[model samples]
Target: MVRGKTEVRRIENAASRQVTFSKRRNGLLKKAYELSVLCDAEVALIVFSSRGKLWEFSSSSRKLLGETLGTCSAAELHELGNQLEESLRQIRKRKQCILAEQIAELREKEKSLLKENKLLHEKFKGGNMLHLNAAEVQSMEVNTQLMIGRPGTL
Candidate 1:
């Protein structure tokens, strides 16, 4: 019997809807997998049924597991190794650049903090404890004790 094109609408029967969803979801996932493999393209598919059941399919390389190595030539293996090395080099370069930027930022902060500490030290001079422009007492031998702590510490 030839099946005619059915109207696209919600299935009235819950059981029929569930069965249809199951069949169609499997078909779509299989198609996606086939497409990814045949085209060497990435495919990701997700399906949620009426009962909130979830099904997902994702396609990525499995060469890391040595599953597809039997089909590779020596040249292919060497090429793969070179690709991995290049990827590692790129990753290391990026990491080093980011670390350099962070170090530079931290050094700038340290410089600013040091400058502030110097200004604070100037505010509490050890000898006079108060700064005046071109003014001095006749007796400069008397001394007092003052306790000071570094910034960001007790």
Candidate 2:
């Protein structure tokens, strides 16, 4: 007969729960050991029981793991810091180049606009105009002259 799948939930009986925990913990430790041996890999396992009992397994000694990991982490952190600093430097350089390019483009546009404005002013001044009085024309001419000499005039 095909058995139905067991519903996984917390065991209500304290004795059954303890038995299950013991079985599972042993199975897990066995698997960990098998994996380390078969793969020739470093493995560590730590388990705590409800009774505050601690179980641990490691392919390497705890002191060796601590020392090696501490040194590796420090070296890795230093390398990472250097890489980040270099990346930031490169980013700043690229940003400066982009800003310079934008500034040059804006300067060129400003110059073009100023030239256009000067031409328009000259055209207006040369044409006969009955609407503008002498003072208005003089004021316009003075403003045009000021704008032409300025560096950032639009």
Error of 1 at 93 (Å): 0.8
Candidate 2 global CA lDDT score: 0.78
As a whole number from 0 to 100, the lDDT of residue 136 in candidate 2 is 78
User: Candidate 2 lDDT, tens digit per residue, 4-106?
Assistant: 9989876999999999999999999999899889999877777879788988787753533233545456776676567557867997999799899879999
Q: Where does the lowest 10-residue lDDT sum fall in candidate 1?
A: 132-141
Candidate 1 accuracy as TM-score = 0.44
Clashing residue pairs, backbone N/CA/C < 3 A, model 1: none
Candidate number with greatest lDDT: 1
